[model samples]
Each structure stands twice: as structure tokens, then as C-alpha cells.
Target: MRRAAASVTIVTILLLLTGCWDRLPLRDLQMIDVIGIDQDEKEQGVTVDLIVTSLKGAGKGQGEPIAERTTLKGPSVIEAVGKTEYMDQGPFLAVNTRAFLMSESFASDKPVEEFKFLLHAPYTSINTPVIVYAGKMVELVNNKSSNRQAPIEKLHNFIKSLNSNGVINNISMHEFISSADEPLEDYPLPVVRYHESKFQIEGAMLFHSGRYAGKQITNEQLRMLMFMLGVDQGRQRITGSVSDSKSGLQDITYGFSVKNVRRSVHTQKGTDRLPMVTIRVRLNINVFDIGDNIDTLKPNYAVVMEKLLGKQFEQEAAGMIRTAQQANCDVLGIGKHIKAFHPKLWKSLDWRKDYPNITIAPKFDIQILNTDGFEQFQ
Candidate 1:
């Protein structure tokens, strides 16, 4: 009788545990791959663009689900997200979001405010990578142009290419959140634009605090910034113009295919009692292209060009450091070192003001290597 009673109790508990509850239908769950944010010029609000991949036929890479886009403009993020339910496309889900792209206006303005929805929203991953774009946010999120691959997959490949090529530094959503607060609040994100129906790195987007400090790093500056960040290894190609002394002020373009990059950095209190930082980069470069310059074929041109390149970068690095300081931005993240190793020093003064006056020393060692079938420029 005791055993039978115990069995009945267990059955009752099981029934209670399995009580009927509101559940989301599988067909109702839509997957969001990317979110693009742009400012509504007409209104004092933001336009949220979501790129969702239809999983109607998603399986084993055999067939592709269609890519659809939706946009909603609201004064706030939550309201905008809420308005999506009324759309004919149905309520969407961001749980499967792979990337987030924000426009210059949105990213630099109230970046934190723009993304706060993700923080409170259910099923959103904090690790989602954030990418910045200067072009039309809609054009970028519209990935239906390519028939070979889905837009999300193409964007993913672009990221891999960006990292491998060292176009600019990439940051994850979590990294931005982690550092967005403390001794280092400046976050530099990668930027891409739709060019020739393809995505290309435009530059690096700079932000101060949670708002835009009215600054951006792009073009040649972007390339130098990436190299200064010590991201010059792998199959990274450094392409830039260097003036040829023999060419009577004409600039010569050169492409250095870097096989390796070794870097070292240190921070200390200068004799002047200011933050002093030094960065040293040693690069093993394969001289790939020396455009319209006979000097590259010179017996000692490799050594000369290497030194010139190092010196040129030294000047370039100084300008970049100065620009960062003027903007009170710490893209290099040297503030962490000061806080970690010298707490007292960090506490003594305002880094924002002292940063501009801080001394930055950059030394680059460029070694030209010989590609067997090509030139012996090493």
C-alpha cells in the first residue's frame, strides 16, 4: 500500500511539472543575422534595419533560405523593436544574430542607448560582433544581390578576410561592453562599405565614451592604425605611397606582403611625470609591388626603402597618436597598462587631459625578404 501511494505521488508531481504553458511556435521564430542602425534625418530618432535569413529550406548547405530585410524607425530602440510585430513579415528573433552594423550617426551618437535593448532582451548574445559602416545602412544590410552565397555568409567571409588581410582591427560585442566602462572607454571598431556590390573596409570608427566624440579614422590612417596595432602578420599586405628622392617629389607606391610582425610595448611614468609609452614593431616584409620606381631594383634599395619606410611610419605613427590624444581617445589601450602597473600614477591625474601631452615613441624595423622566383630585395 505504501509503494502504491508513493507511485501515485510521483505521477502527480510529474503532471504538475508538465503544466500547459504558453510556448513559441517553431514557425513563428524568425532568425536575425544582422542589425543595422541609422539615424532618421527627418525625425529625432533612429531607423533600425534587421537582416533576417529565412530558414524555410535551410539544411546541409543544399539549399538557401531567402534573405529578407525590415526597417523600423522609432524614438527609442524598444519601441522600434516592438513595432516589428505589426509588420506583415511577422515578429522576428535576434537570438541567432551573428553581426550588428551601426551607422556613423547612430554608433557615434548614443551608441550605448542604441544597443541597450540587447542587454535586456531575451536570447540575445553579448558576444555578437559589431561592425560600423559609413554608407547607407540599408544598402549594406541588403544582401540579396549575390546569388552564390547568402548575405550573412558573405559578411562572415568579409570579416575573415578583413582579419587575415589586416585591413583594420575587429571588435566583438562583449569586448566593447567590457571596456566601454572603465579606465579605457574608447573603442575603435571596424568599418565596411558596399562597393561594387561587395563589402570593403572603409576604415576604423572611433568613439569616445558612449557617444561619438566627432572623430573617425579612415583611408591611409586606417592602414597605419592597423599596422601600429601590431596586426601586420599573416598574409597581411601593406600598400602605401612613399616619396622617391630620385623622382623629384613624385610619390611611389609600394606593397609589402608581411609574413611576420613582432611587437613590444611598454608604459612608464616619464621624467616629466606624464604617461610615456613606447611601441616597437619588427616586420618581415616580402616586397611584392614597387610601382614605377626603378630604385627598388637598386642593389641597396631594399635596405634604403626599409629604413625610409620605418621613418615614414614613425612620422605617421606620431600623427595618429596625436590625433587620438586630441580626441581624448585611447584606441591603443595604453590606459590599462597605466592602471594595472602604476595605480598611483593613474589616480594622480586625468588621463583625458594628460593623454595629449603624453610622449609616444614608435620604432619600426622593416626587413625586406626575397621571394624565390621574384626579386632578391632582402
Candidate 2:
């Protein structure tokens, strides 16, 4: 009799169980892949744009995903997102947002301020990657993928290739928050531009105290910057063409593929007791796309190539350091290094004012590994 009563109670419990009470069915939702925010100065408010992807088929078979776009305007970011409820197909699902962009004017002035909604919104993912769009917001939003693929998919692939591409670095939500919290380290974000109707990463956007001040570095310039940071190392270490004052862009000449780089930072006190930073860059390279009238296999030719490439790399690397310093951007985290290892030196001088005048000596030691001598047989 007890067993029968227990069985009856178990059946009653099982009958009362229900699944996914609050779950929203996928078919009823629209997925947003990209979110772009811009300032409407005329309206004195923020304008938000989103790219929503919708599948045409209703479970019969999969149909090609189509992009449905919507724009919302309000006095603030949160209000702008709230205004989306009145748009067709209802509000978008933030779960699919792959990339987020903000206008230069918005990000340059106060980036952390713009991220307030994401922080307070309990459901938003903290890992979502954010980028600053450097061009006109309208021009960027008007862009449809040139290759016929969705812009969201292209951006996703582009970010995945960042480490290998070497030209730029990605700034995710986590990176932004970390950099914002660190007072010494400046923020580094990938700058995007709509060029030739396609999205291209221009370079890194440097921000000091949340102000951009309209400064940017080019891709070639960023390569040297990353080299000195010693973070990229073997990946994306190839520098194309040595430029000359008279002619320009020596792509016909030898191109270098850098590998196995080692970097060290040293400091010394000058006569004025100011700190001096010396950067030593060591790398092995392969010579490819050899120019005409030059033989790489010859011992003398090899020496000349090494000297020429090393000197060129040194000059460019030094220029990159200066560029960063002139803008008062410490992308190298040199100040942090000084604080940790040379605390007295770091505290003695105002780094912001002295950074531009600091003596930064960059030395490049390059070794050529392959001469491509057997190319004729291959």
C-alpha cells in the first residue's frame, strides 16, 4: 500500500513538470548582427543603427538569410534602444550581435560613457567585440557587403584574422574595460573606414583620457609599433617594399618575412638624470621576391641586403615610436614598465610632458635565413 501511494505521488510530480516556460521560440525572433551608434548633433541626441538577419523559410527548408535594417534615434543610447520597440518586426535580439561600432565623434569624446547601457544590461555579453568607426556614420551604415555576403560575416572573419593580419589589433568589451581602468596605459582600438564600398581596417585609434584629438596611425606605421611591443612576433611580421626618397615603394626589390623576433627594453640615467629607453629588436628573415640585377646567394650581396634591411627597419621602427610619443600615446606600455622596474625614475618626471622629448633608441638586428637560390630548379 505504501509503494502504491509513493508511485501515485511520483506520477503526480512528473505530470506537473513543464519545460522552457519563459523561452521565446526562435521563429518569432529577429536576430541583430551589428549595432552602430552615432551622435545626432542637430537633434542633440544619439542615433542607433542595427543590422538584423532574418531567414525567409519557416522550417520547411533553410532559405538564404536576408538583412533587415532599422535606425532608432533618442536622447541617449538606452532610450535609442528602447525606441526600437516601435519598429517593424519588434525589437531585435541582442544575442546575435557580433560587432558593435560607434562614430568617431561619440567614441573620441567619451567612450566609456557610451558603454553604460551594456554594463547595466544584465543580459548583454561582456565579450562582444567593439570597434570605433572613423568615417561618417551614414556612409558606414549605407555599406552593404561588396562580396554579396553579409557585412556581419565579413567583419567576424576580419577580426578572427587580426593576429595573423598584423596590421591592427581588436578591442573587445573586456579590453576596453581593462584599459579604461588603467590610468597609465592608453586605449588601443581598431579604426574602421568604408573605402571603395568595402570595410577596411585603417589602423589603431589611440585615446588619452578618453579624448582622441583626431590622431591616427597608418598600417605600415602600426607594423613597426607592434614589432617594438614584441607581441606579434612571428605572425604578420612581413614588411613589404623599402621606400626611397627619390622613387618610392620598392616592391620590385626584396621583401622581408620576419620570424623569431626577440625584444628587450633597457633604461639608463642621462647627465640630467632623465631616463633613456633603448629597445633592442632581434629577428631572422627570409628574402623573397628578389629584385632584378641582385643576387642573394653571393656572400657580399647577402651582407648588403642585411645592412640595408636592418637600417630601414630601424628607421621605421624609430619613427613609429616617435609617432606614438608625439601623440602622447603610450601604446607600448613603457610607462608601466618604468613604474614596475624603475619606480624612482617613473615618479621623478611627468611622463606626458617628457615622453615627446625622451631619448628612445631602437636597434634592429636582422638575419636573412633563405636566399631562394634553388628557385630556377623548382
Candidate 3:
């Protein structure tokens, strides 16, 4: 009797100790890798596209499943997501989402309103990058990778590269929400497009008062913008033509890597109603390429190149500031600076009305450390 009772107790304990009793089987879970949000054409509903990978059972000899897209529509985000259950695949899980792609129209419609659902959704990853796509959400999510890598993986890696190069901010959903919550602050999101059979982060979407300003920053303007913000990642390369004093030599095109950057912003009471703001940036660079060598060993070579590069950036800064003012975007956070140091001035004026009228001066200082890479020998 005693042996039988001990055996029964052991059996009961073993049964209770078994793990994963409530866990969903892997084969039944459809993991979402990317979410694309877009507005319906009728303007009364939302469209949610889930790029997912479904798992298969053992011994099926099934290779890795290709990512498939499921489009669902409803009046709101929650309802749209809920509709995923009626599909043949298992329930949708968002914890594995790698990125969120928002259509230009959807992002322009009202960024905060459309993003609120993702902010509050349970089990969703908030740190995933939020990108603004130029084309249709369905086509972009379904597009195949050019190099045979997974489309979503390729995009994620590309974004990482751009972020490291200081080309884009790579803003996340959480960061966007935080910036939107703050006063006199705005955010820029990296913009991607399908070009030449591949996805590229070609520009950025600027926001003002939590709405798209209908402006995009690209190429040199984008680089200058990042430089002014003091966010240059030190790996950015710049190329421009500099006047060559050598006789009969055309202007030399030069390329250099940004080795270091020092930036400062100053705002003080001015003779006018709005405060005067000055943005100063100093760039330390290493010259790696010169279209034609004209005695780089000469003592004046570095000095002349530095002055020319400085002038070149000064002009670019003016254009960057113009674009920001036209969009009324305070990318530099000058208003935040005033609010922090000069509370009285910040409280007395409507920043939105005064921002466009204020004068912002950007000054650049360039230092060329070397020219050995392109040095000419007799």
C-alpha cells in the first residue's frame, strides 16, 4: 500500500512539473517581421499589412518559409489586427516585428494619430525603426531583395548602415512618440524608396507640429543637416570642387572623410523682437582623394583647401536653413534651448509664428589633416 501511494505521488508531481503547458506551439505561431500601415483610399479606414513567416512541423522537410504578406482592412488599427485570426495561418504575434513601414500619405495624414495604436499595443516591440516609404505599402512589403537576401533583412541592414554613416536619424516608434510629446520639438524619419530593384534610404521626412511639412531632405542638404545637429558619425565623406591656383589646371574635385566635429549653438537677446541664433561647426577631415595633385606638400595646400571647404559648407548651410525655415521645422531645437535657458523669453512669444522670421547664422570651420593619399611624386 505504501509503495503504491509513493508511486502515485511521484506520477502526480511529474505531471504537474511538465513545462510549457500554456505555451503556443511553434508550428502554430505566425511571426510578424514587418508591419506596413497605410490609409484606405476611401479615407474612412486603415490598412495593415503583415509580413510574416509561418513555421512547419518536424519531418516535413520544409526549408525556411518565405515571408508572405497579409493585407487586412478595418475602420481602426485594433479591428484590423483582430481580423488576422480569421486567416488560415495561426494567430499573429507582433513581438518579433523588426520594423514598421508607413506610407507617405498615411504618415502625412496625421503622424501621432496613426502611431498611437502601435504605442499602446501589448506585446509589440517599441524599439523597432519606423520608416516612411515612398510607394504603396503592399508593393514595398512584397518586394523581393536584389541580392537574394530576405527583403526585410536587407532593409534593416541598410537602415543600420545609413545610421552609422550619419545619413539618417533612424528614429524609433518610442523616440517619435517622445519627441511628439515634447513642446517646440520635432522629429525627422528616414525615408526609403524602391529604386533600381533595391530599397534605399534616399531622404528624410521632416515634421512640424506633429505633421509632415511636405518637404524632404536629401543628398548634400541632408548631410549638412546632420552636421548642424552634431550627429555626424565621423565616417561621412564629402566631395566638392576647390579652386586650383595651378596654371591651366581645372578646379580639383576632392573627397575627404570627416574625422571629427565640434558644434555649438548660441542664442541671446537681439536688437529685434526674436532672439539671434548662431550655429558654429568645426570639421576635422582627412583627404583621401584629389582629382589632380598640385604639390600637396606645399605649406599652403592645407590652408587653401581648408578655406575653400569652409566656404563650400557655409553656402550649403544657408540652403539647409532655408529648407528648414520653409518647412518651419526647428531641427536644431533652438526653441528648446531658449525654453531651457531663457524661460521668460520662451513664455512671451509664439515660437511657431516667430520661428520663420528669426535670423539663424551657420558658420563652418574646416581643418584638413592630411593629403598623403593623393600626394604626387616626381
Candidate 4:
């Protein structure tokens, strides 16, 4: 009797259950693969470009392509999205969207804080990779690859490569928010440019206090910066001459690749007068090429590599400090260091006011772990 009563109750609950209230059928919806945001030259407002992908059935004798695209634009992102509603299709869904490309002009003029509202919207995904382009968004979305993968997938894979290789700082929505909120930290966004047949990562956009600070760093300098911050993953080729132990007058040329980098930051308290900041870096390397053989190279290789690396590291550190000082931007988290070590002093002095004058000391130690082919020469 109890089982019969429970079955009746379960059937009643099942009868009340229905499909999602806001769900739209896939067949009746226009699927958007890419969204572009830029400044509208004619309207003095933002322009939203939607790239819609549709599929048509193949005829009996023909094999049709799987996807087709159509574009729609409007003064606002939402309006541009709504323009597709009049189509025979029921609605447009961007939840499956893979990429969002913003023009440099739009990103510079519109602070990211203004766009945070979109995070609350139902369709946008937080993990959707965002790319800032110096050129038009249309050009980016229309890019075709010789490879068979969809354009969106190709672009997403490229971004993943850049992040894993540490070529540029990967600035996501969460990181952007944290940097913007912190008083001491600044944000850097990867910059992209379209040149001829290919797209290239130009460098990074440096931001200070929620505004576009007028400072940009090149890819080479960015790599060096990442090395100092202990994020080095990309390949580096170094060429230099080292002195032979037996023959002081003879110089041997050598080249190597950096396999890994580890770094840490230290701060010395400021008495009522001065404060000091020190950065220490350790590098692991592999020798790939040698121009000449030095029998004594094995023992002295560490010393020579350390000196060369120390000089290179110092140059990069000084350049970063100068770049931020000139723009009055603090992207390195120097303020956080001060706050962590000397809270009382950090509270008394404003970092922004004193950052331009602060002194920095950088030290580096390079270790050669394995020589890929130097064993033959030895």
C-alpha cells in the first residue's frame, strides 16, 4: 500500500516538470560564433558586429559545406543582437560563442568596469577568451585558416599557445578585476595586430588606475619581464664569447637555451628616510651550440653564464622600472610588497607619489644543467 502511494506521488511530480522556460531550440536559433566591439565612426556610439554561422542541407548530387556566415551590426551590442530576432528563426543564442574581439579604440575609451555588467547577462561565458585588436573586428572574425578547423577554434588554440609559452601576460576577466581593485597593482592586456595574411601578437597594453596609460612594451622586452617575474616558458637563444682558462687571449663563442626560470621579490624596510626593493632570479639553461672548444669551459661555464645573465637581467629590470616610472604606472605589484612588509610605512606614504623616485636592485644567478651536445666537444 505504501509503495502504491509513493508511486502516485512521484507521477504527480513528474507531470508538473516541464522544459526550461527560456530555452530555445537549436534548429530555430541563429548561432553566433564571434562578436566584435568597436567605435562607430558615423554614429558616435559603439558598434557591435555579430558573425552568424548557418548550415544548409546538401542536395542529392552535391555535398554542401557545413557552415555559412552572415553579419549584422548596430549602435549597441544588445541592439545588434536583437536585430536577428525578426528572422524566421526563433531567437539568437551566443552561449556557445568562442571568442570576443574588441578594437583598441573601443577598449581604450571604454573602461572595463563599464562592461562588467555583461558578466551578469545570461549568455556570456566568463571563460570566453577575449582579445584586443588594433585593427577592425571584422577583419579578425573573417580570417580564414588553411587548416580544417573553424576560425574560432584556430584563434582559441593560438591564444592557448601564447599563454602556455608565456609570450604575453594572460589577462582574463578575473585577473583584470583583481588588478583594478587593488590599489598597488596595474593590469596588462595582450595586444594583437593584423598584418597581411597573418595575425600577430604586438605586445601588451599597460593600464594605470583604470585608465589607458600611454606605455607599451615590445614582445622581446615582455619576454624579459616575464623571466624576471619567474614566468619564462618561451625559447631564448643567447650568443656570446667566453674566455678560455688555459689561453687568456683566446675567446670561445657559445650559445644556449633557457630551460626554466625561478624568481622571488624582497623588500627592505624604509626607515623614516629610504626604502629598498630587491628582485632575485634563478635560471636553468641548456647549451645547444658552441663555436669553439675550451677544455677549461666545464669548470668556468657557470661563472661566465652568471655574469652574462646578470647583466641581461639588470637591463630588463631597469627598463621595466623606467617604463612604469615614466608612465606613472605600477604594474609590478611593488605596492603590495611594501604593504606586506611594512604596513605602517606603506600607510603613511603614497606609492603613486613616491614610485617615480623609488630605487630598485636586481640580482640574477644562471645555472647550466645539461649540455645537449657539448659532451661530444669535451
Candidate 5:
């Protein structure tokens, strides 16, 4: 009798359970893939473009997925998004957004207010890639790949490759949103240009205090910055002349694939009453290429190559540091490190006012781990 009563009670409890009470069917929702934000030609209002993708059959298996383009304009981002309710399908879903593309001008002029909506929205994903493009937001969103893949998909793959190769540190929505409020740390957005039905990542735009600093760095410089910032060491490659040829005809240029890197930042108060920072980087690399000439190899070649590469890297790092200082971009997060480790020093100085004036020195130590001359063939 007790077992029968217990079974009956369990059945009653299961009957009262409510599962997904407010869930909406997929057929009733609009799925957005990419969102583009930009300012109007007059620079007085916001324009939003969305690439909405939805299956035509709605699970009936009748046709291919369809992509619809929609544009909305308003004086602000929130208003533009709100306009969707009146003009388009109800309850839009953006959880699958692959990326957010913003115009250069829009990113430069007061972007914090424009970005607030995305941060507060419940449907948006924080991991979406945020990029700054050179051309019209509409054009970029409407572009189609020759291979029939979505242009935004192609762009996302390109960014992913750059991140995996350690070429550039891809910035996500959460990073961009948080950096705006972080006083010491800044962020970078990969710049894209669409031409001839192709999207190419040109360089990167540096942001300081949530605003574009009117400064851009070349793609080559971006790679060095990635190492300086101590991103994950992927299959990174660097090329430089390690030594001159035996005939003295020209410099022997070689390519090196970085295997490991150890970087450290030291902060001190200089005798001149200024903040001093020293960045030391140690790299372990393998010789990736040695050209057609095998006669260039000599006794103690690895040691000589290490010294030459280290010197060359130090010079390049110094120039990169200067560029960041000049642009007032603390992309290396030196100020953040000082704040965390040296709170007293951080309290005594205004980082924004003194960052450009601070003295920063970069040092590099390169070690060639494998120069067996077989890498060229491999």
C-alpha cells in the first residue's frame, strides 16, 4: 500500500511541472547573424544594419536558409533598436551573432553611449567579434562571397586565423565594453576594408579611454604588439637579417618561427622623478628558412644569430613602445600592472596625464633552438 501511494504522489508531482512555459517557437523569431552600426552622413544620427537569417521551411525541410537585410535609423542606438519592434518581426534573436561591425567615424566619436544597448541587451552574446571597417556599414553587410559563403562568415574565419597565428589579438564585445570603463587598460579593434568582393584585415585601431586615438598601426607592427602584450604563443613567425653573407654581397635574411616567449615588465621611480618601465622579452625560436645558400652556415652560427636577432628585436620594440606612447594608447597595460602591484605609486600620479611622458625601455633575448638546416625542406 505504501509503495502504491508513493508512486501516485510522484506522478502527481510530475504532472504539475512546467517546462519552458514562455518559450517561443523558432518559426516566430528572426535570427540575426551580424549587426552593423554607423553614423549617418550628417554625423547627427545612428544607422543600424542587420543581416537576419532564418530557415525558409521552419523545420519542414522545404528550402534553403534565407538572409534578409534590414536598415533602421535613429538619433541613438537604443532608439534604433527599439524601432525594430514597430517595423519588423516580433522578438528578434541575436544570440547567434557572429560579429559587430562599426564604422571608423562612429567608433571614434563617443562610442560608449552607442555601445550601451548591446551590453544591456539580454539576447546579444558577449563573445561576438567587434571590428572597425573602412567603408559603409551597409555595403559591408550586404557583401557576398564568391564561394557562396556569407561575407560575415568569411570575415570571422579570417579573424580567427589571425588570432590562432598570433598576428593580432581579436577583441570581443565584452573586452570592448569593459575597456571603455577601465582607466589604465585600453583595447584594439582590427580594421577591415572591403573591396572587389573581398574583406581584408588591414591593421588595427587603438582605443584609449573608450575613444579612438586617431592613430593606427600597420599590420607588421600589430604582430609585434601582440607579443609585447603577451598573448598566447601560437605559430608566430618573424623575419630579420641575422647576419651578412660570407661574400659580403648582402644581408642574410632568415625567417624564424617562435616556439616560446617569456616577457616581464618592471616599474620603478627614476632619479628624474618620472615613472620608468622596463619590458624584457626572451624568445625561443626555430630557423624556418635559410634561403638557397648553404655556405652561410659557420661555426657558432646559432650563437651569432641569437645576438643579432636580439639586437634587431630590441630596436623594433623600442620603436613600437614610442608609437604607443605617442598615441597615448596603453595597449601594453603597463599602467594596469603598476596599479595592481604598486598601488602607492599609482595613487600618487594621474596615469592619463603621465602615461605619454613615462620612460619605457624594451629588451629582447633571442635563442635559436633548432638550426639543423632541415627546416627549409620540411
Candidate 6:
């Protein structure tokens, strides 16, 4: 009787543990690797493209191309996602999705509040990479990778490379939301595009108060901004004409593989009227290249290089500021500086109205920390 009672208790426990009746087998569950969001041209709705990876021995390669893509449309993001089943599967699982690609049209449509809500879904992963493309999401996904890597992994690697190079800020869902709510700073999203059968970071999208404000900054402008923001790393090459005493309009190129970038912004109250913003940037550069042989390099090559770099930096800074001001956008975080130093004054002034009138004086101080292989010029 005791043995039977123990057996009965074990059977009851096993039955209780088997309550996960809704659990699908691994073979039955469809693992989604990528989700693409775009705007519907015909209807005022959102279209979702899902790239699903099947586990059924499709091939021997890992992340093999057994992936299937389907498009669904609906009035809202949730509805659009829910309607994804109409394309192929009766019902699909997306908890294993690796990335989300949002089309520029869909991203710039409105407040992006609905998208934010979709991000909070139980199946959505916070760490999943998000990319912004300009064309149809499906087309972007269909673009082939040159390296023979999976499309999703290729996109992930491209974004990661851009972030590591400090070419653009990482614009994840969390970062976007945080910047949108910030009263002093504008949110910048890294833009991706398919070119020449490969993915690239075109530039960054600047937003003011949750809306697309204007055109993106150029690649050079993005580099300069990265330097100003103290995030510049890797190599930056600047080539221009140096008016030599003898060689009239000589082509001189200077390559700086940056070691560090230190910057500071100071606002001064002038008696004349509007406050003046003074920006000082100190750069530690590794001199990697020069135009000609090091033996023929000028004695004042370092000084000339510094001057040329300074001019270039100044021009870039001025262009960035002018473009932002022209677009009625403040992306340089000038408001944050004011709030930090002059809280009372900032409170009294309306940044939106006063941004157009703000004056900025940028100063650059670049020093060559190491000459590396090009030390002959020194």
C-alpha cells in the first residue's frame, strides 16, 4: 500500500508538471530572424515583413537561406503584426527575432508612439538591433550580401562597425525614446542603405521634438560632429592645397588616426545681448600620412598640418551649426549646456525661439601625439 501511494504521488506530480500544454515543439515553432516595418502606399496603414527561419534540416549551413519572408498590412502596428499569419503561417512566433528594420517613411510618419508601443510587446526583445532604411523594407531585406553572410547578420555587422567607428550614434529603441523626451537634446538616428550589393550607414537622421526636422548631415559633417562630441576614433584623412613659398598651391594631405578628443563648451554673458557659446576641442592625433617623402617635408610641417586641420574643423563646425539653424533644429546640445551653466537664465529664455539667434564660436587645438611610421616628417 505504501509503494502504491508513493507511485500515485509521483504520477500526480508529473501530471502537474505537464501543464504546459500550449508549448509547441522546437520543430513546429518558426524562429523569426528579422522584422521589417514600412508604410503602405495604397492604404494609410503599416506593412510588416517577417523573415522566418525554419529548423527543418533546410541545409547544412548555419543561418542557411531556408528563410521565408512574408508581408502583412493593417491599420496599426499591432494589427499589422497580428495579420502576419495571413501571408503564410496560420500563426507565427517572433520571440526569437534578431533585428527590426523600420523604413524612413514609417519612422517619420508621425509621433512614432504606435511603434514604441509595439516595441513593448512581450515577444519583442529590447536588445534586438533596429535599422532605418529609406526604401521598401522588403526590398532592403532582399538585397544580397557580398560576404556570403546571412542578410540579418550583415545588417547587424554594418551597424556595429559604424558605431565602433564613431560614425553615428547607436539609435536603439531605448536611446531614441530617451532622447525624444529630453528637453535639451535632439535625437539622431543612424540611417542605413543598400548600395553596391552591400549595406552602409549613409548618415544620421536628425529629429526635433519627435518629428523629422530636415536633411541629414554629410559624412564629413558626421565625422566632425563625432570629433566635437569626443567620440572620434580610428583614422581621418584631410587633403587640401597648401600654398608653399616656392611650390605654389602644392597638394598636401594629412592623415590623423585619432587617439583622443577632448572638448568643452563655455557660454559667456556679453553686455551687448545674446549669450556667446565658445567651443574648444583638443585632439590627440597619430600622424599617419603626409603628401610626399618625409625627407622633403617642411620643417614646419606639424604647424602647417595643425593649421589646415583647424581650418577644416572650423568649416565643418560652422556648416553643421548653420544647417541645423537653417532647419530650425538644435542638434548640438547647446540647450543642455545652457541648462547646466545658467539654469535661471535658461528658464527665463525660450530655447525654441532663441535658438535661431544663438551665436557659436568654435576653436580647435590639434596636437600630434605620435608620428608612428611617418616620424621622418618630424
lDDT of 6 by residue, 172-279 (tens): 655554555665557566778876667777777777766677667776777777777777654444444444444343566656466678989988876655688878
- lDDT on C-alpha atoms for all candidate structures: 0.71, 0.69, 0.75, 0.65, 0.74, 0.69
Model 1 over residues 1-378: C-alpha lDDT tens digits?
Answer: 999999999999998887756544445556676777788888888888877665565456554555677788898766777786687544435434777788877776767765655666665667867888877887766555433264567787887677667776567766665554654777667777777766777767677665565666766666667666777644766787888575343466888677777777877767987867898888787776755344335536666677778888888877777777778888777777678778898898687888778888888888877533245343
State every prediction's TM-score relative to the real structure. Answer: 0.81, 0.81, 0.83, 0.78, 0.86, 0.80
- Model 3 earns a TM-score of 0.83
Clashes of each: 1, 0, 0, 0, 0, 0
Error of 1 at 109 (Å): 1.2
Query: What ordering of candidates by lDDT runs from best to worst?
Result: 3, 5, 1, 2, 6, 4
Candidate 5, residues 1-378, lDDT tens digits: the string is 999999999988886774455655677656666788899877589998877776666776554557777787889877777777676555335434777888998898978767766776756677877888898887876674322265766776877887787777777877777777777657677898878876788888889867887788877667667777766456677775644454342566888777777889999898775688988887877676544334354437667667766776777777777788888999899988998999898888887788899999888777766555534423
* Ranking of all candidate structures by their TM-score, best first: 5, 3, 1, 2, 6, 4
Q: What value of lDDT does candidate 1 attain over all alpha carbons?
A: 0.71
Question: In model 2, where do residues sit more than 4 Å from their true spots?
Answer: 1-30, 54-64, 85-96, 145-148, 237-240, 243-252, 292-296, 372-378
Residue 293 lDDT (model 1): 48
The candidate with the higher lDDT, 1 or 4, is 1
lDDT against true structure, model 4: 0.65
Off by over 4 Å in 1: 1-28, 57-63, 86-95, 141-153, 244-252, 268-271, 290-299, 371-378
Compose the digit string of candidate 3's lDDT tens values, residues 1-378. 999999999999998878556665556656677788888888588898877766545346654555677788988766777775677653445434778888898888776765666666655677978888888887776675322265677777887888887887777777776666666767577778877667777668888756787787776777888888887683787777766465333677888788888899988878977888989998887776655463453446667667777877888888878888888898878888888888998887799889888889889998766644343221
Better of 3 and 4 by lDDT: 3
Candidate 3 lDDT score at position 313: 84
Where is model 5 more than 4 Å wrong at Cα?
1-18, 58-63, 91-96, 145-148, 240-251, 291-296, 376-378
Better of 2 and 3 by lDDT: 3
